[model samples]
Target: MTHRLALLLLLIWSTPLRAAQEDPASAALAAMHQLEAATVALEEAESARDRVRAYTNTIRAYETGLAAMREGLRRAATREVELTRRLSAQEGELAQLLGVLLTIETAPTPVLMLHPTGALGSARSGMMLADVTPELQARAAAMRQNLEEVQTLRLLQKNAVRTLNDAMASMQQARAGLSMAIADRTGLPSRFTEDPVRTAILIASTETLAGFASGLSEIASGDIAGMMASISDQKGSIDLPVQGAVLHGAGKADAAGIARDGILVATRPRALVTAPTAATIRYLGPLLDLGNVVILEPQPDTLFVLSGLAEVFGKVGEVVPAGTPIGLMGGEAPQIGAFLSLSGEGNGPERSETLYIEVREGDSPVDPETWFRTDKDG
Candidate 1:
């Protein structure tokens, strides 16, 4: 009874140990399956709304699954080392057992039965042989299990690499499609014309972002007080000009380590930049330290400045409706570098660009986060 109880306890403990060893790989596989499902959903989505939802889900799932994969790979590496050591030990034990078996088989019948210490020595030798046999069998079984585990781990690692490649490709395709959609939708007419003389002056005289912003504020004449008042009333409920992730919030340092007074959004190449609210294009020109910039006046004292455009659509003094396209993000399609640097996952060699936005009330910068709809809000 006591021997049976001891065996039962050993079985329970060993079962749990094996289960714990397998848990990480199992969990990682589950996460990868979830990510695959999300990517499929993204690929199958027909509408913009559905695509956006699926894309968000895919991003989240990919991140989660990637983390799990990394952890599982680390654990597998550790397990491989342990298995190698155990297999070596088991091989040594098996060799010793074989040597003993050979000795017993080759010995004469009388010699096997006889002992130096008479009958007591013979009985002790028989008991030791009985004990060693079961241990040898257990070691063989354990070695086999370890070999199987190592094979499984190698297969998992290979699958993970393939899945990661597929995921990155899908992300790139989705971003490109999104950029095309935005460009197609941003075909609004310019209500005003470009002022080349003023543009040149703004380009030459504006030494800093603040100076450029001040110049833009003075360029346009105020019009339609009622519309401006209505826009001001909806201060905190406005949508951003471009649809993408916020790379840097207001007052955050940019890649150049300069603290910006506005928000920086990382979006797909050639993404359409639009007017957040009903505003007139106060200034449209390239200034020092900023790319092609577009300034809009929603009211007499309120100005919205957008910079880093590849192409400007609106002209100076153009009165654009809310959600009107003003320009496009500066970059060619199929950009092979970091699309969104905020997440820090560069998504292969395709790099996305940034659109900088600043809202000013008579030269004082306002936090765009309070006004613009963020990813959380979307």
Candidate 2:
């Protein structure tokens, strides 16, 4: 009996130890370290072009790592709770088993055998002991499993904290590199001057998006003929001016109940905004309630209005090549707090710094999603 009990204890402890060897958290931790290396590469990039590419790679890596870490933490927390409950139950079972053993050791063997029920009572008691022993052994095995789970969960929690800190630091460095890249480009000449009187009239007379677009169409200066691609041909192939997720697509009602004529993209704070195609800037500055705006006319009949900019680069009527840096988004880095917010995690609010993109064909609002390459379209 003693040898069997010892063997059960050994099996209980060794089984969980072997099972605990398979861990997914180590892979997540390794990815985070790779992201840290990418961040270092971004910081060391020499040219504006290199910096841009490196920054994008680093951001992507950090986002991926952050997501992995968050998932790891969540799974660990759940496992910890489950193991804690199992441990409590096993402890209770152990205490009961110990009490039974103590009672058996204290009571006289003759008393147990010569009870009132005599031989029948002794037979029943022996049967009960035979059943309880296996139950006690099972409970002990469960306790060992719970202990291993608890240890694994602790390691996961620690890794999550370390990864989060590293991600934050990488984000800060990437933000700084983006700022420096923006500052390096200078001397973009304007081809047309802003018509202040006309702009004022348009702002005061227009109330709806369609009206505002029409009003701008009348005052917009610059002949885009032979300078850009045909807008109709580029449908579904054109890239967005900024890299981000589409928060509200065209014809969708925003939180204010206003149906947008364009798409709103939620991006990191101070993210570099670029020209999606070869277009001449027709209008640059604030208009109505929209923040600083940049109007680009890729063709005579097509116009793209980008609003909610914190700063405007290039001058009015300046012709820019495709992917030219135009401006930066408003606010600080990690705009909406953390990458977890991108996945709708936590209670933190969504990013308020949105890039509003409006595409118009001859004064009529067209759905930007139909033309631009959004994630949903892909």
Candidate 3:
């Protein structure tokens, strides 16, 4: 029993080892290494006394690796089981052939047949049957061929399964290691607390993305600019039926700002959406971080993006004079559009209605600060 147990273990271990030599197994191993690396990085990040953002990112990486490992493992297991069943069936057929051979050798022949063209067609018919008949030989050959096919399939399956299993195990190990590292680094549960600020930030960010998307839709609909001008002229603001902060700093985005007062105000000439139609009522809902965004086409060529307001005034195609009340910041703590300029490269050119608000005088980039004056309260 001990020997059997030992052999079984050896077999199991060697099976994976042999499988690792196969192409699929090798690929699986490679993937497993990637998973391990990701997991390790996650752990290291967690361990290094870093910010909550860093730790959260590490955790996310571990999860992604874990997911990939699981998917690979599932595929491997399915293939392995399918191949194993086929192998078993082939083995059974071989065994039946052996049984037939044994019966032919043990049983006696009841009668002999003669051919018209020969004195004796066959002398050792029973003997020939016992050893191997043409039919039985063909069957045996077919069985052998099937066995070979099954074995080859089994080999491939084994390799694939081993590769996947190893990768999964490695990933799991890495994840555990990273978790340990994070725990050691953060002394964690201490890190766990009510993050109301983060929650609010996320909610605000999501709203912003949504608003941007909506504005893009309006742009695509070709009504954004017109609507903004109309909103600026008539209503004090175009409410998205939503309430949130507009954290505008100009250039490309990297962070968000919170409002402490009732609303954040855009004191200067904020870039508004450019459009052709007059008044497009594309409503933005409540709780959008974009606060309020309205598009306005000052001229046929120039477009503006205005945010941080509740209601805006201006009409589409209506040549409004400078210093119109496009809208006012309506958040807890409203802010101003401090500066605006061209978007630096790497933030690909705006493809949607989302405009990268830039101020230019002909070919030269102009600072929006120089053009739009700040309101007294702004």
Across 19-101, the per-residue lDDT of candidate 3 in tens digits comes to 44554334344445444454445445434454233333333343333333333344444444555576677777768888887
Q: Tell me the deviation in Å of residue 142 in model 1.
A: 4.1
Q: In terms of TM-score, which candidate is stronger, 1 or 3? A: 1
Using TM-score, give the best candidate's number: 2
Give the residue spans of candidate 1 off by over 4 A: 1-24, 47-50, 59-119, 126-142, 184-205, 209-378
Give the TM-scores of the predictions, in the order they appear: 0.46, 0.61, 0.26
Worst 10 residues of 2 by lDDT: 1-10
Whole-model Cα lDDT of every candidate shown, in order: 0.62, 0.65, 0.37
Q: Which is the better candidate, 1 or 2, if ranked by lDDT?
A: 2
Which tens-of-lDDT digit does each residue in 1-378 have in candidate 1?
133333432332233234335654564455456446546544544343433333333343443344344445556556666777777767777677667666766888787677899999999987887788677667656667788887776677567666666755665565455445444444434444555666567668767877877775344344322332446678777877875678889988888898889998886565666778888777776777688888888877788889999877655765667765566676665422222221123232232788888888877899987667776411
| Cα displacement (Å) at residue 109, model 1 | 13
**Backbone clashes counted, model 2:** 0
Preferred candidate (TM-score higher): 1 or 2: 2
